[model samples]
Target: MTKRIVVLGVSGSGKSLIGKSIADTLGYPFFDGDDFHSQANVDKMRQGTPLNDDDRKGWLATLNAILTDNPSAVIACSGLKPEYRAMLRNGLDDVTMIYLKGSIDTIWQRHQKRDGHYFNGREMLESQFATLVEPTEDEALVIDISQNADAVLKEALTLLANSPTH
Candidate 1:
């Protein structure tokens, strides 16, 4: 059976990298949530402005539609708040929520070196951390971001394989 996977985390937590890797391994398509954000939203993040719930409603809806369209996909998104996660979960079957859990310092340090991204360094990261509602034990398959990208991907795939879905 095809599974819908959401690779979620704060910025710099390797959502895009890990999600894409997992997608390739699973022979699924990858969708980066950043690419679907509205220009206004992008501008706000570019300016280090944190987006409120109202600002994300449309964006989440659009991403939810993508999940609906593709049964098996690896989607990299910052599913920060509970409401946002719920919205993403709406009308989905076989959905796997993968939360890339990481320490603020670890992510912040990594964010500093990243270039050509709209998300500003520490400021944007602080906003994301402040708004994050960490996924609970039942809500997601959590993985530590302290691990290397290859290890993280392997761990994720192992978890998926061992799951009842198989």
Candidate 2:
């Protein structure tokens, strides 16, 4: 059976990298949530403005639609808040969320060396940290980000393999 998984984390937590790997390994298409953002929203992030909930509502709705439409897929998103994760989960009966848990310092270091991204690392780092509401025990699979990318991906896949869907 195909499974829908959401790779969630704060920015710089390797959601995109790990999500893609997991999707590839499982032969599921990967969708980066950033791609669903409107140009205006992208611009706002580029300017280091933390998006208010209102700014994210439409985008979350759009993501939920995509998940609903393609039930056999993996998605990478910064599901920073509990409500946002619930929004992403809307109407998706078969969904597994993998939260890439990381420290602010680790994320900050990763962001500092990151290049070719529109977001300014220093400006957005604090806001990302501030806005993050870590996953609850009942909510998702939590993977520590202190591990290497490959290790993280492997761990996630192992968890998924043992998951009820598999």
Highest TM-score: give the candidate number: 1
Give per-residue CA lDDT, model 1, range 51-157, as digits (tens).
89998999999989999999788889999988899899888767788899999999988888888999975877898999999998688889998988889989998
In terms of lDDT, the best-performing candidate is 1
What stretches of model 1 exceed 4 Å from their correct place? none
Candidate 2 per-residue lDDT, tens place, 1-166, comes to: 3389999998899999999998898888899998999898999988888788998999999988888988588999999999999999987668889999998888888998888887776668788878889887578888999989989988998888876531
Q: Which stretches of model 2 miss by more than 4 angstroms? A: none
lDDT, candidate 1, at 80: 99
RMSD of each: 1.5, 1.6
Q: State in Å the error of residue 119, model 2.
A: 1.9
Each prediction's whole-model lDDT (CA): 0.88, 0.87
Q: Given candidate 2, what's the lDDT at residue 154? A: 86
